[model samples]
Target: MKTIDCLGDMCPIPILKAQKALKLSPSGTTIKVVTDHSCTLESMLNHFKKYEITSTEVINGVWEIFITKS
Candidate 1:
């Protein structure tokens, strides 16, 4: 699992990074993204619906979004 810290990033930055990660990662690879923004999390959740992904709340306003490339 590769982790991308998007704690301070906003909007398209987080989603953009996730896209790059997915494009670079091999099949079945899971990339873990840490975000502190609700909008960022929501964007990722909806954007990642096309693939295998999961989300876990680590704490208040903090989440770990895992995306496994299909």
Candidate 2:
């Protein structure tokens, strides 16, 4: 699993990074996205509908979103 740290990033930055990772990585790769903004989480959840969301957990106001490439 690879981790994309978007703790301070906003909007398309995180999504863009994820998209780049997906494009570069092979299929079935698992990624963990760490974000502190709700909007980022929401955007990811909505944008990554095509991928498999392994899990989402909010701890101490930070969200950890896990997705597996299909």
Candidate 3:
């Protein structure tokens, strides 16, 4: 899985990074996104809601989103 770290990034950055990664990745690929911002997480989920989101959970207090290209 490819990982995009958006720890200190705010709105749009995380989404942009995810977009870039998705564009480069093939269909059915799974990517892991790490973000510390709550708004980012919500925005990401909302923005890419059409894609397959495998999981959204907090690990060690940080939010992690797993999305699969479809």
Candidate with maximal TM-score: 1
**lDDT (tens digit, per residue) of candidate 3 on 1-70:** 9999999998899999999999999999989999888887788779998898754657655788888999
User: Distance from true position, residue 17, model 1, in Å?
Assistant: 0.5
The total of clashing pairs for model 3 equals: 0
Q: Which stretches of candidate 1 lie over 4 Å from their true place?
A: none
Count clashing residue pairs per candidate: 0, 0, 0
lDDT of 2: 0.87
lDDT of residue 16 for candidate 2: 96
Each candidate: RMSD = 0.8, 1.2, 1.5
Q: Model 1 over residues 1-70: C-alpha lDDT tens digits?
A: 9999999899999999999999999998999999999898789878889887788889988999999998
- Regions of candidate 2 where Cα sits further than 4 Å from its true position: none
**Candidate 2's residue-wise lDDT over 1-70, tens digit each?**
8999999998889999999988888999988989988898789889999998754656776888888998
Question: What are the Cα lDDT values of the candidates?
Answer: 0.91, 0.87, 0.86
Record all residue pairs in model 2 with backbone atoms less than 3 Å apart, i.e. clashing: none
